[model samples]
Target: MTRRPYRDLVIFARGGGWGVDRAADGYDPVAVIRGTDFAAVRSGRTETVPRRWEKRTLIVPRRVRPGDVLLEISGGSVARGQTTGRSLFVGPDVLPAFELPVIPASFCRLVRFDTTLVDPRYAYYGLLDMYLSGRAGDYENQSTGISNFQFERFLDAELLRVPPMAEQRRIAGVLAALDDKIEINERVVTATEELLRAEFDALAVTGHGSVPVTELVEFNPRTPPPERAGAPYVDMAALPTHVAGIRSWSHRPPRGGSRFRNGDTLLARITPCLENGKTGYVDFLAPGQTATGSTEFIVLRARPGVPPQFPYFLARDERFRGHAVRKMAGSSGRQRVNAADAADFRISVPSPERLAVFGERAGAAFTHMAGLLAESRALQSLRDALLPELMAGRRIRPAPAPAVTGAATDDAGSSVYAQ
Candidate 1:
């Protein structure tokens, strides 16, 4: 194994060339990926944002290639923290029909690897490990409130230990196997959600009746924190843009966040986050448990006869989101949705019998999706635990599949690791 400056492995690392021109939102109509889009990619979820609705852009536009790795460049957190340094590689699975050269916004940078010198997949996972391990954070420039990483400086000062190409491939394959199952499970969850949405659409067509959101659900209900500290706390980031559930949180002093109990839906009401679709259903907490999160959240809980999942799906719907975006009022960066406007928006309500039926179906589907999400978390834990050991030259194959799959052999007569 040999060590090399991080820069020697890349052909070019540059910031995005073009930005969203606010003046051209409708006129430009160009497809673009921004720092916000990274949230969807990171969560293994896909969301469609109309080109005309994206915020103002920079004049320069940098086209993305399939193999290029996109990294967030501007944010409060730097290279080491979960708040920043999120990376996603552009590939066929992510953009199968990517015909036109989609531009990257200024807040993102594209890093192209020299595949002849390194395996791209291996490099991606390696970078991920570095970030997770906090090794990458050592190179960050922390002169201001936001942590920033300069690629040129990182390449010059940082050293990457390169394993033999064969080992790199093997390491990547093992890790990717875990990721493949996670992705597969995510796809299943997405499909289930789409079905539920279809049912909602159908119910809307029948026109049982309609009521304002406030009439059907509680808005920002108050849940005063316990006299003590260390309650579960969730920031905006914990609520993913398109993911079905929250996978992370912290225990902190009860302070300054919208409070809610289990089964509540937390929908981001601020500019970029709202526009990006950051919403999460609260199921991770124990029964009767209460938690608080960024005040930017609008807490919605179903009223009597309404399914617990109703508010979650309603917040996730495109129409509701579009309406919220339209009602946002404020300065360029500080815009927020007017709570009154949101509460006043009319939502179609089904008849009691039909509502109960839809509730059962949607509840069943969500329960299954939550189970899959839990399994994916376990697989991710295994992959993360194995990554460092594999990168350090420890030769160990993954343990044979547990009886989870109900069979010892896969379709090819090999032992299955997972379904």
Candidate 2:
């Protein structure tokens, strides 16, 4: 093992580009992963990654590959204590999520390690440790309210402890195993939700009757405030665009916000959020518990006799979303859809018997998804706890030979080796 300057192990490092919006004469479309998308992309959620056209010449050089790392070079919120040096490791499992060729966005840079000197996965863990330890913040420069990572300075000043190749692979393998499980869980949850959507679409085509949505769902229904001083509070940002589950929340004093109980759907009422498909199902709260959230939420709850999960699928329905979008009023950017307008929109309702059957299936799927999410959280906690100790060469000692497989493969059978 030896300590060396961080730059010594890097074979390539360059900032990314934001190509034109349209595919011009010499441009090809590519998926651009931005700093904001690091978490989603890492979790195998690629729907939010934007597509942009870039010159083939530029694309060839910036194209992302398995084993590379995407480093955020700009943009962070001081108030949130977020630094600009966060990174995402592009493992074999993450590449298939993109339909087009992938590249980091302008505010990010692609980093590739020298395989002979350090394992890319091991290098990534080192970078992650730096960020998690807040050491990355030491190299940040603030200007005009935006934080920028001083990449050159970081490379010159930081030192990394590199072990033998076999040891590097062993350490990386242990961490990757945890990540692989989390990724698999996410994929399963995504597939389950997609299946539910398909079932909902099928039912929509053969419903018993048509009626105003208000008859089935009560929008923004009034509810009594929680008695607890600090109740679970979900802000607008906690709402997910493509998934039904809300993964994050905080405890705060309830002070005049939309209040909802479990089994309710929270839809973003504001322009960009609504248009971007920001919605969530309230299933994280304890049984009979009520939570408060952003006033920008329009809570949708099923009426008696309706399926409890109906409002969530309805909120995600294309036709229902289009109606809500068309009903937007107020100023341009701040436009919002009225709760009454959304409630008045009509939809075909399945017979009570059929509804009950659909509910049984969808409810089971959601329960399974919730369980998977809980497991992922636990795995994440375990990974976080082990990361620092392993990186510091404590607790687990390096093996004489690699204790795991030489390469990690994704569901598509594509493989990424330690190199």
Best TM-score among the predictions, by candidate number: 2
Give candidate 1 misplaced runs (Cα > 4 Å): 12-14, 19-31, 42-63, 76-84, 97-99, 142-146, 205-210, 222-229, 318-332, 335-341, 395-419
> Which lDDT values do the candidates have, in the order given?
0.70, 0.84
Model 2, span 311-388: residue lDDT tens: 999899888888899998998789999899887677787888888999999899899898888767766665676678
TM-score of each: 0.80, 0.90
lDDT leader: 2
Count the clashes in each prediction: 12, 0
Residue 338 of model 2: what lDDT? 83
lDDT of model 1 at position 362: 82
